[model samples]
Target: MNARLQPFVLTIAAALLLLGALTYSARAADPEPAEAPRPALTVTVVQPQRMAIPMRIAANGNIAPWQEASVGTEANGLRLAEVRVNVGDSVKRGQVLATFAPETVLAEQAQIKASVAEAEAALAEAAANAQRARDLQTTGALSAQQINQYLTAERTAQARLEAQRAMARAQQLRLGQTRVVAPDNGIISARSATVGAVLPAGQELFRLIRQGRLEWRAEVPATDLGRVKPGQAVEVIGASGSRLAGKVRMVGPTVDVQTRNGLVYVDLASSDEARAGMFARGEIEIGSSQATTLPQSAVNLRDGFHYALRVGPDNKVSQLKLKVGRRLGDRIEVLDGLPADARVVASGGGFLGDGDLVRVVQAANAASAPTPAPAQAAAPAGR
Candidate 1:
């Protein structure tokens, strides 16, 4: 009985072992399962646009008086008796600014007046003598030569009297010259005259800014000088961040050879913030023109160049180089290098490279994504 059962068990055990081996060999022969493909990046896109933009030229310059009026003394070798105005004082035309010592002029005028009085007496006597000579000539009561001599003496006295009167008038003019008056309405920028200080004729006493007006002398590049025209509006920015409005008055006739720049004179509207000798930056509006533009977010800067991620029909992104111009607000002008109808990534372009697979997402859907709630705190165990 043991021999027969042992043979049957041995056969069953051998068949079980063979089945296990075959199962193991089949599992080892099968290939591994493939990995899943990565999901495409989702992004928002926008189209190029066209709009009008202002053309302007930026320049820097100093503010100065529109015209400087130099006031000088007319009375030579006279001591300045009084100065009525100082630096930064406003004066009107015909206003007295200074006065020279009038003592010497007054004394000379008195001497001339005495001489004039003496001449009047001499002319009266000459008139009587001339009448007598005329009477004698008709009667021939005296020789013709004697009568002629009397007439000639009378004429000489008359001439001397006339000369004395002219001297008196000149002396009067000298007295009037002692007072210095403002030539124009203006603000005094400098003063050199002082009380009791002797000054010669034609010596400057004060420098006035005519009409208190100022101008901005913008130094523009010679190449851009032609773009600046008279009557164009300009905005000047001061160092204190104040803005002053001005108009282009004129452009210099010649360009400076050393700096390659030209002067564009701009008349500044009167403002308290604007003053002479101030350095300011200005922008002059040349005109306006149409330009192709895009949102600033759509452009990306890479490797020191500007690029935009252009999407293809298959929703794939390609980096496109662009030439950019003036930028205003959130929009930038595309001067060239982009098609009008091309779609570009609205934002997050910096994260993308050329030829990247992307998923086009509606802007409304992306903006509507629910914000994640803050994590809740753990509760006490005993609660």
Candidate 2:
């Protein structure tokens, strides 16, 4: 071997060793495989439950008197002398409400009585004359024409006496009419009669709420009128946020042509807050039926619609649009768009989006989880 050939062989061996070292270093610096992402959120879930949902019909209306009694004067051209009751006064049946001046009526009655007495005296005289006429006719001592005239006079006097008695009775009735009395037990709602004011016949003096009772005139849609029946329970929500209990009295026979609405008269239980002419809203419970219900926390409102977060077996959530019905406390009826067995996110759903991965925690587990201690300030360094 020549010396130049030996140097070349050693150089080739060194280059090969360096190439192997570089290859090992590159393999060692390669990064490890990345891990799959964990669940981004933890949430509690719930399932639909079957419950009895009450069927109710909603209505709006005004409060009014059950029956308004229009009290008016029957005596004509009588001056009211005294008024015993005013608006808002409670009255009993036959209670005196007002009194007219009785002087004129009494005087007229006295005059009729005197006339009646005079007629009675005249009738007695005529009866005596007729008896005499009859006696003389049998004896043939009086002519038939003269006897008939006496008899006719007697009959005329008798008729006049009866007429005077009838007039006297009429005058007595007029005297009684001077006093205005309550026709029925009620509360006075309005009054137009005043002392010293002369009123004519049939003039209204007071308006009374019969038996102090109030009613709610609910206007229900004509299509739903058939559902209302007598004696059904009603819950009325008043303008002041008070709830009143009532019962359905009757359904109107006809519906309004323009609004296609029928009226339902509901008798409200007596209450101080209930007043006539107040606008109110209410619901009538017709019946009940089974329904699939879910907690309100499980439902979401977005984009003018309701939604629920449905959890799949893969721990992925899908947003579901919901058709919901009547809502009770903390629970809502699921009318459509959801299966009875579906599991939905109970709460914290507002922070989630569709198709997001989630970790489910049961109610018991969530309740039992250890509460994190509030962070404490670090102690001053070796104070």
Candidate 3:
């Protein structure tokens, strides 16, 4: 029984020895476990460009009428019968904006006409008597004193008729004044007249923006006033995001003592979106200057500051804080923090961290770069 048990133990030992040998061989053939080296990001790099950037002076102010004309009732103490125009109405020169009670003026004019007619009739009779007296004097049938009295009467009647006509003319003028017309082509900005409301002479019925023109009066720093000049091109941006093209009409002759600010008057072209009393911001194009600029896409904003991802010789990215300036179109001025000869990631810097390894390529090649394939299991050691 002991010999049989020994044989079975020997067979089991042999099988275990063969199994251990195979395991050792498989372990020897396996590859080492380690991560493959790959770049953190494939990116396009760009160099700063020296370009001519337009120099502009920024300011803020209100949009207002270029010139305002007051439209008022010329005749006094007349009731506003009809208001033909309202606020925001576009009007032409001599266009009727309001009408007063013309009945009263017309009645006065009629009375004046009657007086003139009566005077004219009296003058005709007096003239005929004066002519007869003169003829009789020459014929020795009339006294000189009587003839002289007739001549004086004719002259007085003539003067009275002229006075009556002048009064009639004045009454007619009043009648015309009952209707208020626009003094110039404009848009009505304010309306004070109402139907049946009696207004006095020179009472404003409407306020018109002369020629429908508008302007931006910007307050600029007094220290920068010398940079502004008349006729310089300006671009005004309103609160509603409306852009208006304008030219500098004039700069204020004096600056405020307390605020140290001056006014720049910019005459803007008419636009439907622009209105009086709207606050706005604008830039005056003073001139152009050479500046180092970069594309906006290449810049990153983080923690309330701007940054650029600059690439090093070793292909590692160094996050650089940037001091940026004016922006025009797709380019932004780099005032500092970036060397002129350094290359930076064109875009996608937001996804990276400092000292990140990246693969740099040309823009044209980057667009056509193929996506990396997924890693696969290593081939079996023997295979």
Highest-TM-score candidate: 3
Report the C-alpha lDDT of model 1 over 1-383, residue by residue, as the tens digit: 69869999999999999999999999999868999555367888888776666677889999999999999988889999988999999999999998888999999899989998988898888778878988888888888888887888788888988899999998888888898999999999999888999888899999999999999999999999988899998888887888888899999999999999999999998988988999998788887678787777888877767899999998788888998887655667787889988988889888888887888876873332232211111111112
How do the candidates rank by TM-score, highest first? 3, 2, 1
TM-score for each prediction? 0.73, 0.77, 0.80
Model 2: residue 75 alpha-carbon error in angstroms: 0.9
On lDDT, the candidate that comes out on top is 2
**Residue runs of model 1 more than 4 Å from their true location after superposition:** 1-47, 297-303, 307-321, 342-383
Clash pairs, candidate 1, are: none
How close to the true structure is residue 58 of candidate 1, measured as C-alpha lDDT? 83
- Write down the TM-score for model 3: 0.80
What's the residue-level lDDT of 286 in candidate 1? 82
Q: What is the C-alpha RMSD of each candidate to the true structure, in Å?
A: 11.7, 11.6, 10.7
| Model 2: ten consecutive residues of lowest lDDT | 374-383
Let me know the TM-score candidate 1 reaches against the reference structure.
0.73
Off by over 4 Å in 3: 1-36, 301-306, 319-322, 353-355, 365-383
Cα lDDT computed for each candidate against the true fold: 0.84, 0.87, 0.86
Q: Rank candidates, lDDT, best first.
A: 2, 3, 1
lDDT of 3 at 222: 88
Q: Model 2, 78-146: lDDT tens per residue?
A: 999999999999999999999999999999889988998998898899889889999999898899999
